[model samples]
Target: MIDLLEIPGFVLDDEREELLAELRAIPGTAATVLSQDMGGRVQPNVRKTTRLAVSPETRERVKEWLMDAKDVLAARFGVALGDCEDPQFLRYEEGDFFVPHQDGNTPLVHDASRFRRVSTVIFLNERSGEPRQGAYGGGPLVLHGHYRTHPGLRVEAPADPGTLVAFRSETTHEVTPVTHGVRYTIACFFRAADAP
Candidate 1:
Protein backbone atom coordinates (compact mmCIF):
# COMPACT_ATOMS: atom_id res chain seq x y z
CA MET A 1 0.00 0.00 0.00
CA ILE A 2 1.07 3.60 -0.59
CA ASP A 3 1.55 5.81 2.47
CA LEU A 4 1.18 9.58 2.54
CA LEU A 5 2.65 11.05 5.69
CA GLU A 6 3.36 14.39 7.26
CA ILE A 7 6.48 15.11 9.25
CA PRO A 8 5.73 18.40 10.90
CA GLY A 9 8.60 20.82 10.36
CA PHE A 10 10.56 17.98 8.81
CA VAL A 11 12.29 20.59 6.67
CA LEU A 12 11.99 24.03 8.15
CA ASP A 13 10.88 26.75 5.73
CA ASP A 14 14.37 28.22 5.68
CA GLU A 15 15.97 24.85 5.11
CA ARG A 16 13.58 24.08 2.29
CA GLU A 17 14.46 27.31 0.50
CA GLU A 18 18.16 26.73 1.02
CA LEU A 19 18.03 23.22 -0.38
CA LEU A 20 15.93 24.33 -3.33
CA ALA A 21 18.42 27.03 -4.09
CA GLU A 22 21.29 24.56 -3.99
CA LEU A 23 19.49 22.20 -6.34
CA ARG A 24 18.70 24.97 -8.81
CA ALA A 25 22.30 26.17 -8.78
CA ILE A 26 23.48 22.84 -10.22
CA PRO A 27 24.43 23.14 -13.89
CA GLY A 28 22.44 21.26 -16.50
CA THR A 29 25.30 18.93 -17.43
CA ALA A 30 25.91 17.98 -13.82
CA ALA A 31 22.44 16.57 -13.35
CA THR A 32 21.68 13.18 -14.84
CA VAL A 33 18.64 12.92 -17.10
CA LEU A 34 15.91 10.68 -15.77
CA SER A 35 14.65 7.62 -17.65
CA GLN A 36 11.16 6.46 -18.43
CA ASP A 37 11.87 2.74 -18.49
CA MET A 38 14.07 0.81 -16.09
CA GLY A 39 16.22 -0.17 -19.08
CA GLY A 40 18.01 3.16 -18.36
CA ARG A 41 17.29 4.96 -21.60
CA VAL A 42 16.64 8.73 -21.46
CA GLN A 43 13.36 9.49 -23.20
CA PRO A 44 12.64 13.10 -22.24
CA ASN A 45 9.20 13.28 -23.76
CA VAL A 46 8.10 10.21 -21.86
CA ARG A 47 10.07 10.96 -18.69
CA LYS A 48 12.00 14.08 -17.93
CA THR A 49 13.78 15.25 -14.79
CA THR A 50 17.25 16.17 -13.62
CA ARG A 51 18.96 14.41 -10.73
CA LEU A 52 20.86 16.94 -8.65
CA ALA A 53 23.88 16.17 -6.52
CA VAL A 54 23.68 16.50 -2.74
CA SER A 55 26.53 17.33 -0.40
CA PRO A 56 27.94 14.62 1.88
CA GLU A 57 26.44 16.33 4.93
CA THR A 58 23.03 16.50 3.25
CA ARG A 59 23.35 12.88 2.24
CA GLU A 60 24.01 11.84 5.81
CA ARG A 61 21.03 13.80 7.06
CA VAL A 62 18.77 12.23 4.44
CA LYS A 63 19.91 8.75 5.36
CA GLU A 64 19.11 9.46 9.00
CA TRP A 65 15.64 10.62 8.01
CA LEU A 66 15.16 7.47 5.93
CA MET A 67 16.00 5.32 8.91
CA ASP A 68 13.63 7.29 11.08
CA ALA A 69 10.92 6.92 8.48
CA LYS A 70 11.63 3.21 8.35
CA ASP A 71 10.97 3.01 12.07
CA VAL A 72 7.69 4.85 11.66
CA LEU A 73 6.56 2.57 8.85
CA ALA A 74 7.58 -0.50 10.76
CA ALA A 75 5.50 0.56 13.72
CA ARG A 76 2.48 1.51 11.65
CA PHE A 77 2.51 -0.92 8.73
CA GLY A 78 4.75 -3.65 10.08
CA VAL A 79 7.17 -3.21 7.17
CA ALA A 80 10.81 -3.84 7.92
CA LEU A 81 13.46 -2.17 5.78
CA GLY A 82 17.22 -2.14 5.82
CA ASP A 83 19.98 0.04 4.47
CA CYS A 84 19.01 2.80 2.05
CA GLU A 85 20.81 4.08 -0.98
CA ASP A 86 22.06 7.63 -1.36
CA PRO A 87 19.23 10.05 -1.89
CA GLN A 88 18.63 11.49 -5.36
CA PHE A 89 17.50 15.09 -5.55
CA LEU A 90 15.29 15.55 -8.59
CA ARG A 91 14.04 18.69 -10.29
CA TYR A 92 11.01 18.45 -12.51
CA GLU A 93 10.48 21.45 -14.72
CA GLU A 94 7.80 22.25 -17.22
CA GLY A 95 6.74 19.31 -19.40
CA ASP A 96 8.73 16.74 -17.39
CA PHE A 97 7.13 13.39 -16.54
CA PHE A 98 7.70 9.70 -15.92
CA VAL A 99 5.66 6.71 -16.98
CA PRO A 100 4.52 4.03 -14.57
CA HIS A 101 7.12 1.52 -13.35
CA GLN A 102 8.06 -0.63 -10.40
CA ASP A 103 11.37 -0.33 -8.53
CA GLY A 104 11.91 -4.01 -7.82
CA ASN A 105 10.55 -7.58 -7.74
CA THR A 106 10.60 -10.17 -4.98
CA PRO A 107 13.20 -12.29 -6.71
CA LEU A 108 16.69 -11.20 -5.83
CA VAL A 109 19.33 -10.62 -8.44
CA HIS A 110 23.04 -11.39 -8.23
CA ASP A 111 23.71 -8.07 -6.45
CA ALA A 112 21.67 -7.77 -3.28
CA SER A 113 22.35 -4.09 -2.86
CA ARG A 114 20.47 -3.23 -6.05
CA PHE A 115 17.17 -4.59 -4.86
CA ARG A 116 14.75 -1.91 -3.55
CA ARG A 117 12.18 -3.15 -1.05
CA VAL A 118 10.59 0.23 -0.40
CA SER A 119 10.71 3.55 -2.20
CA THR A 120 10.44 6.96 -0.52
CA VAL A 121 10.00 10.42 -1.99
CA ILE A 122 10.02 13.65 -0.02
CA PHE A 123 8.28 16.64 -1.57
CA LEU A 124 10.55 19.62 -1.23
CA ASN A 125 8.63 22.42 -2.94
CA GLU A 126 5.14 23.53 -3.83
CA ARG A 127 3.45 23.07 -7.21
CA SER A 128 4.23 26.05 -9.45
CA GLY A 129 4.23 28.66 -6.69
CA GLU A 130 0.85 27.68 -5.34
CA PRO A 131 0.52 29.60 -2.06
CA ARG A 132 0.43 27.40 1.00
CA GLN A 133 0.32 24.49 -1.45
CA GLY A 134 3.19 22.89 -3.38
CA ALA A 135 5.95 24.31 -5.63
CA TYR A 136 4.68 23.78 -9.19
CA GLY A 137 1.75 22.74 -11.24
CA GLY A 138 0.57 19.53 -12.96
CA GLY A 139 3.20 17.31 -11.37
CA PRO A 140 1.78 14.88 -8.85
CA LEU A 141 3.15 11.63 -7.46
CA VAL A 142 0.65 9.08 -8.66
CA LEU A 143 0.73 5.71 -6.96
CA HIS A 144 -1.17 2.84 -8.56
CA GLY A 145 -2.62 0.35 -6.15
CA HIS A 146 -3.93 -3.15 -6.85
CA TYR A 147 -6.52 -5.03 -4.85
CA ARG A 148 -7.76 -8.57 -5.30
CA THR A 149 -11.20 -7.32 -6.29
CA HIS A 150 -10.45 -3.94 -7.78
CA PRO A 151 -8.06 -2.76 -10.45
CA GLY A 152 -6.97 0.66 -11.72
CA LEU A 153 -7.15 2.20 -8.28
CA ARG A 154 -4.79 5.13 -7.90
CA VAL A 155 -3.91 7.88 -5.42
CA GLU A 156 -2.45 11.26 -6.31
CA ALA A 157 -0.11 12.49 -3.63
CA PRO A 158 0.38 16.21 -3.86
CA ALA A 159 3.87 17.68 -3.66
CA ASP A 160 3.43 19.57 -0.44
CA PRO A 161 6.54 20.80 1.32
CA GLY A 162 7.74 18.49 4.12
CA THR A 163 5.52 15.66 2.96
CA LEU A 164 6.93 12.13 2.77
CA VAL A 165 5.47 9.44 0.60
CA ALA A 166 6.52 5.80 0.75
CA PHE A 167 5.33 2.56 -0.73
CA ARG A 168 6.41 -0.93 -1.67
CA SER A 169 9.12 -0.63 -4.28
CA GLU A 170 7.21 -3.03 -6.47
CA THR A 171 4.16 -0.79 -6.56
CA THR A 172 3.64 0.95 -9.89
CA HIS A 173 3.92 4.73 -9.75
CA GLU A 174 4.66 7.74 -11.94
CA VAL A 175 5.00 11.53 -11.90
CA THR A 176 2.62 13.50 -14.08
CA PRO A 177 4.14 16.15 -16.34
CA VAL A 178 4.98 19.49 -14.79
CA THR A 179 2.87 22.04 -16.54
CA HIS A 180 4.33 25.14 -14.93
CA GLY A 181 7.09 25.95 -12.44
CA VAL A 182 9.67 23.63 -10.96
CA ARG A 183 8.94 20.70 -8.66
CA TYR A 184 11.74 19.59 -6.38
CA THR A 185 12.00 16.25 -4.53
CA ILE A 186 14.33 13.84 -2.80
CA ALA A 187 13.81 10.18 -3.70
CA CYS A 188 15.52 7.17 -2.11
CA PHE A 189 15.35 3.39 -2.33
CA PHE A 190 15.69 0.91 0.53
CA ARG A 191 16.68 -2.74 0.69
CA ALA A 192 14.98 -5.50 2.72
CA ALA A 193 18.33 -6.50 4.16
CA ASP A 194 17.08 -8.86 6.85
CA ALA A 195 14.97 -10.87 4.40
CA PRO A 196 16.61 -13.61 2.39
Candidate 2:
Protein backbone atom coordinates (compact mmCIF):
# COMPACT_ATOMS: atom_id res chain seq x y z
CA MET A 1 0.00 0.00 0.00
CA ILE A 2 1.01 3.64 -0.41
CA ASP A 3 2.39 5.32 2.70
CA LEU A 4 4.94 7.75 4.12
CA LEU A 5 8.07 6.32 5.70
CA GLU A 6 10.57 8.38 7.64
CA ILE A 7 14.07 6.96 7.37
CA PRO A 8 16.46 8.60 9.80
CA GLY A 9 19.73 10.11 8.63
CA PHE A 10 19.85 8.66 5.12
CA VAL A 11 22.88 10.56 3.86
CA LEU A 12 24.55 9.71 0.58
CA ASP A 13 28.25 9.04 0.05
CA ASP A 14 30.87 11.78 0.27
CA GLU A 15 31.16 11.86 -3.52
CA ARG A 16 27.39 12.14 -3.85
CA GLU A 17 27.24 14.88 -1.24
CA GLU A 18 30.02 16.77 -3.02
CA LEU A 19 28.21 16.54 -6.33
CA LEU A 20 24.93 17.75 -4.82
CA ALA A 21 26.50 20.61 -2.88
CA GLU A 22 28.36 21.74 -5.98
CA LEU A 23 25.25 21.52 -8.13
CA ARG A 24 23.07 23.45 -5.68
CA ALA A 25 25.75 26.13 -5.55
CA ILE A 26 25.57 26.58 -9.32
CA PRO A 27 23.45 29.18 -11.12
CA GLY A 28 19.82 28.02 -11.48
CA THR A 29 17.88 27.62 -14.70
CA ALA A 30 14.40 29.01 -15.48
CA ALA A 31 13.51 29.50 -11.80
CA THR A 32 15.25 26.17 -11.05
CA VAL A 33 12.58 24.57 -8.85
CA LEU A 34 8.88 24.41 -9.71
CA SER A 35 6.69 26.42 -7.38
CA GLN A 36 3.87 24.66 -5.56
CA ASP A 37 0.50 24.49 -7.34
CA MET A 38 -2.18 26.68 -5.78
CA GLY A 39 -5.46 24.94 -6.56
CA GLY A 40 -4.39 24.65 -10.23
CA ARG A 41 -3.00 28.18 -10.14
CA VAL A 42 0.61 29.18 -9.44
CA GLN A 43 0.74 32.08 -6.97
CA PRO A 44 4.45 32.50 -7.71
CA ASN A 45 6.58 32.39 -4.56
CA VAL A 46 10.36 32.53 -4.17
CA ARG A 47 10.49 30.04 -1.29
CA LYS A 48 10.16 27.21 -3.77
CA THR A 49 12.67 26.44 -6.53
CA THR A 50 14.08 23.09 -7.58
CA ARG A 51 17.63 22.75 -8.94
CA LEU A 52 16.79 19.49 -10.76
CA ALA A 53 20.47 18.65 -10.70
CA VAL A 54 22.63 15.83 -12.01
CA SER A 55 26.23 15.27 -13.02
CA PRO A 56 27.72 12.53 -15.24
CA GLU A 57 29.78 11.30 -12.30
CA THR A 58 26.81 11.13 -9.90
CA ARG A 59 23.82 9.92 -11.97
CA GLU A 60 25.10 6.35 -12.18
CA ARG A 61 25.68 6.02 -8.45
CA VAL A 62 22.29 7.56 -7.72
CA LYS A 63 20.55 5.35 -10.27
CA GLU A 64 22.08 2.30 -8.67
CA TRP A 65 20.94 3.45 -5.27
CA LEU A 66 17.41 4.02 -6.46
CA MET A 67 17.43 0.57 -8.02
CA ASP A 68 18.44 -0.85 -4.69
CA ALA A 69 15.72 1.15 -2.96
CA LYS A 70 13.14 -0.14 -5.43
CA ASP A 71 14.24 -3.74 -4.95
CA VAL A 72 14.16 -3.38 -1.20
CA LEU A 73 10.77 -1.72 -1.27
CA ALA A 74 9.36 -4.42 -3.50
CA ALA A 75 10.65 -7.28 -1.40
CA ARG A 76 9.49 -5.71 1.83
CA PHE A 77 6.10 -4.40 0.69
CA GLY A 78 5.27 -6.67 -2.24
CA VAL A 79 5.10 -3.69 -4.53
CA ALA A 80 6.45 -4.01 -8.04
CA LEU A 81 8.64 -1.09 -9.03
CA GLY A 82 8.54 -0.53 -12.76
CA ASP A 83 11.33 1.99 -13.14
CA CYS A 84 13.21 4.78 -11.37
CA GLU A 85 15.19 7.53 -13.05
CA ASP A 86 16.34 11.10 -12.71
CA PRO A 87 17.22 11.78 -9.10
CA GLN A 88 17.14 15.54 -8.59
CA PHE A 89 18.06 17.84 -5.73
CA LEU A 90 15.63 20.75 -5.25
CA ARG A 91 16.96 23.95 -3.72
CA TYR A 92 14.64 26.60 -2.29
CA GLU A 93 16.08 30.03 -1.90
CA GLU A 94 15.15 32.65 0.68
CA GLY A 95 11.57 33.97 0.61
CA ASP A 96 10.61 31.11 -1.68
CA PHE A 97 7.39 29.15 -1.10
CA PHE A 98 5.57 26.28 -2.78
CA VAL A 99 1.78 25.96 -2.73
CA PRO A 100 -0.14 22.89 -1.65
CA HIS A 101 -0.39 20.09 -4.21
CA GLN A 102 -0.04 16.34 -4.65
CA ASP A 103 2.66 14.82 -6.88
CA GLY A 104 0.57 12.53 -9.16
CA ASN A 105 -2.94 13.46 -8.10
CA THR A 106 -3.22 16.04 -10.84
CA PRO A 107 -3.28 14.69 -14.39
CA LEU A 108 -3.09 18.31 -15.46
CA VAL A 109 0.56 18.35 -14.36
CA HIS A 110 2.75 16.46 -16.82
CA ASP A 111 3.37 12.78 -16.10
CA ALA A 112 6.71 11.03 -16.04
CA SER A 113 7.97 9.06 -19.08
CA ARG A 114 8.44 6.17 -16.70
CA PHE A 115 5.37 5.28 -14.67
CA ARG A 116 5.65 7.50 -11.57
CA ARG A 117 3.80 5.71 -8.79
CA VAL A 118 5.61 6.76 -5.64
CA SER A 119 7.60 9.90 -4.89
CA THR A 120 10.45 10.28 -2.40
CA VAL A 121 12.20 13.35 -0.96
CA ILE A 122 15.33 13.25 1.14
CA PHE A 123 16.53 16.25 3.10
CA LEU A 124 20.13 17.20 2.42
CA ASN A 125 20.49 19.99 4.96
CA GLU A 126 18.45 21.65 7.68
CA ARG A 127 17.19 25.13 6.98
CA SER A 128 18.21 26.26 10.45
CA GLY A 129 21.64 24.71 10.08
CA GLU A 130 22.34 26.77 6.94
CA PRO A 131 23.66 30.28 6.91
CA ARG A 132 20.96 32.91 7.33
CA GLN A 133 21.78 35.88 5.23
CA GLY A 134 18.63 37.74 6.29
CA ALA A 135 15.89 36.85 8.75
CA TYR A 136 13.19 34.59 7.20
CA GLY A 137 10.98 31.64 7.96
CA GLY A 138 12.53 28.19 7.67
CA GLY A 139 11.44 26.25 4.59
CA PRO A 140 9.06 23.73 6.11
CA LEU A 141 7.20 21.18 3.99
CA VAL A 142 3.45 21.47 4.60
CA LEU A 143 0.49 19.34 3.64
CA HIS A 144 -2.65 21.42 3.34
CA GLY A 145 -5.33 18.73 3.05
CA HIS A 146 -5.83 15.16 1.94
CA TYR A 147 -7.08 14.25 -1.55
CA ARG A 148 -10.52 12.83 -0.98
CA THR A 149 -13.85 13.67 -2.51
CA HIS A 150 -15.71 13.17 0.75
CA PRO A 151 -13.24 13.97 3.52
CA GLY A 152 -9.74 15.46 3.66
CA LEU A 153 -6.81 15.13 6.06
CA ARG A 154 -3.90 17.44 6.75
CA VAL A 155 -0.21 16.48 6.59
CA GLU A 156 2.74 18.59 7.69
CA ALA A 157 6.39 17.65 7.22
CA PRO A 158 9.43 19.72 8.04
CA ALA A 159 12.55 19.51 5.86
CA ASP A 160 14.87 18.03 8.45
CA PRO A 161 18.41 17.29 7.28
CA GLY A 162 19.32 13.68 6.47
CA THR A 163 15.72 12.48 6.62
CA LEU A 164 14.16 10.50 3.76
CA VAL A 165 10.39 10.61 3.29
CA ALA A 166 8.57 8.24 0.93
CA PHE A 167 4.92 8.68 0.05
CA ARG A 168 2.49 8.25 -2.77
CA SER A 169 2.84 10.93 -5.38
CA GLU A 170 -0.80 11.78 -4.80
CA THR A 171 -0.22 13.12 -1.29
CA THR A 172 -1.20 16.76 -0.99
CA HIS A 173 1.90 18.62 0.14
CA GLU A 174 3.58 22.01 0.00
CA VAL A 175 6.81 23.72 1.04
CA THR A 176 6.43 26.61 3.46
CA PRO A 177 8.10 29.82 2.43
CA VAL A 178 11.61 30.55 3.60
CA THR A 179 12.11 34.05 4.91
CA HIS A 180 15.88 33.71 4.51
CA GLY A 181 18.54 31.23 3.38
CA VAL A 182 17.97 28.14 1.24
CA ARG A 183 16.56 24.63 1.70
CA TYR A 184 18.29 21.68 0.02
CA THR A 185 16.63 18.33 -0.75
CA ILE A 186 17.05 15.26 -2.94
CA ALA A 187 13.84 14.29 -4.77
CA CYS A 188 12.88 11.25 -6.85
CA PHE A 189 9.76 9.69 -8.40
CA PHE A 190 9.03 5.96 -8.64
CA ARG A 191 6.74 3.90 -10.87
CA ALA A 192 5.24 0.47 -10.27
CA ALA A 193 4.30 -2.02 -12.99
CA ASP A 194 4.54 -5.59 -14.20
CA ALA A 195 7.92 -7.08 -14.96
CA PRO A 196 9.46 -6.31 -18.32
Could you say which candidate leads in TM-score? 1
Judged by lDDT, which candidate is best? 1
The 10-residue segment of model 2 with minimum total lDDT is 33-42
lDDT (tens digit, per residue) of candidate 1 on 49-78: 877767888778878877877777655545
What would the TM-scores of all predictions be? Answer: 0.80, 0.73
Model 2 segments more than 4 A misplaced? 12-17, 31-47, 75-78, 105-114, 129-137, 149-152
Candidate 2 backbone overlaps, count:
12
* lDDT comparing candidate 2 with the true structure: 0.60
How large is the C-alpha RMSD of every model relative to the true structure?
A: 3.9, 5.1
Clashing residue pair totals per candidate (backbone < 3 A): 10, 12
- List where candidate 1 sits over 4 angstroms from the true fold: 1-8, 28-41, 106-114, 128-134
In candidate 1, what residue range of length 10 has the lowest lDDT sum? 29-38
